[model samples]
Target: MPCIRDLRIPVSTILGQLATGRAAGEILEDFPDLEPDDILAALEYAAAAVQERELPLAAR
Candidate 1:
C-alpha cells in the first residue's frame, strides 16, 4: 500500500475520508501533519492505479 511521505499514513485512509464526504481542509485539520499536496497525491495515485486496466464482467 502507498503511504504519505513515509508517514505511515496509507493512501486508502485518505481516500476513505474523502469517500465519507470529508473536505480536504477537514482532513488536514484532523491530521495537522498532512499537507494539501499529500491528499492530492493520494487521489492521483488511486486514479492512476485504476487506469489502463480491464476487469472481468459477467455475461447477462
Candidate 2:
C-alpha cells in the first residue's frame, strides 16, 4: 500500500475535491492504497487551514 503522506501532489487538492462532494471510496477507486484515515487527515488539515485563514507562501 502507498503512503497517503507520501503522495507527491498536494493533499489540499484532494481535500478540496472531497469537501465538494467526492467520496473517500471513490478516491480510493483510483488510488487503491488510500484509506479512510488518509481522507480524514486531509480534511483535518484543510479545516485547520481554513479556520485559521493561514496562507503559506507555497500555497499562494
Candidate 3:
C-alpha cells in the first residue's frame, strides 16, 4: 500500500526523525522534497494505524 507522497521517503523515517526530536522545520530543511503537509500526513497515518483495532479487540 502507498504510505507517503511520491515515495520520496518512508513515513517510518519521518517518524524516526520526529522521535529523535527533530522539529518540523528541521525535517523540511533536511528533506527539501517534503512539504509541510507530508509531515502532517505522516503523523495522521501513524495515528490512524495506531487507532485501528482488530474485530475481536473492537468487540471486546
Candidate 4:
C-alpha cells in the first residue's frame, strides 16, 4: 500500500477520513506531520488506480 513519504500513513487512511466527511484541514490537524499536498496526492493516486480497465463479470 502507498504511504505518505515514509510516514507510514497509508493513502487509504487519508481516503477513508475524506470519505467520512473529514476536510483536508481537519486531517492535517489530526496528523500534524501531514501536508495538504499529501492529501491531494492520495486523491490523485486513487483517481489513477480507477482509470478505465477491464473486470471479469458473470453473464446475465
The number of the candidate with the highest TM-score is: 4
lDDT of 4 at 35: 94
Task: Give me the overall lDDT of model 3.
Answer: 0.88
Report clash pairs, candidate 1: none
Residue lDDT tens for model 1, 36-57: 9999999999999988977799
Expressed as tens digits, the lDDT of each residue in 14-51 for candidate 3 is 99999999999999998898989999999999898899
Q: Can you give the lDDT of residue 22 in candidate 3?
A: 93
Full-model lDDT, candidate 4: 0.96
If ranked by lDDT, best first, what sequence of candidates would result?
4, 1, 3, 2
Q: Estimate each model's TM-score.
A: 0.84, 0.63, 0.79, 0.85
lDDT of 2 by residue, 1-60 (tens): 222587754686676667789887888786776777888887777677679565668755
Worst 10 residues of 2 by lDDT: 1-10
Output the TM-score of candidate 1. 0.84
Q: What's the lDDT for all of these models?
A: 0.95, 0.70, 0.88, 0.96
Of the pair 2 and 4, which is ahead by lDDT?
4
The alpha-carbon deviation from the true structure for residue 2 of candidate 4, after best TM-score superposition, in angstroms, is 1.1
Error of 2 at 27 (Å): 0.6
Poorest lDDT segment (10 consecutive residues) of candidate 4? 1-10
Clashing residue pairs in candidate 3 are none
Judging by lDDT, tell me the better candidate of 3 and 4.
4
What is the C-alpha RMSD, rounded to one decimal, of candidate 1?
Answer: 4.3
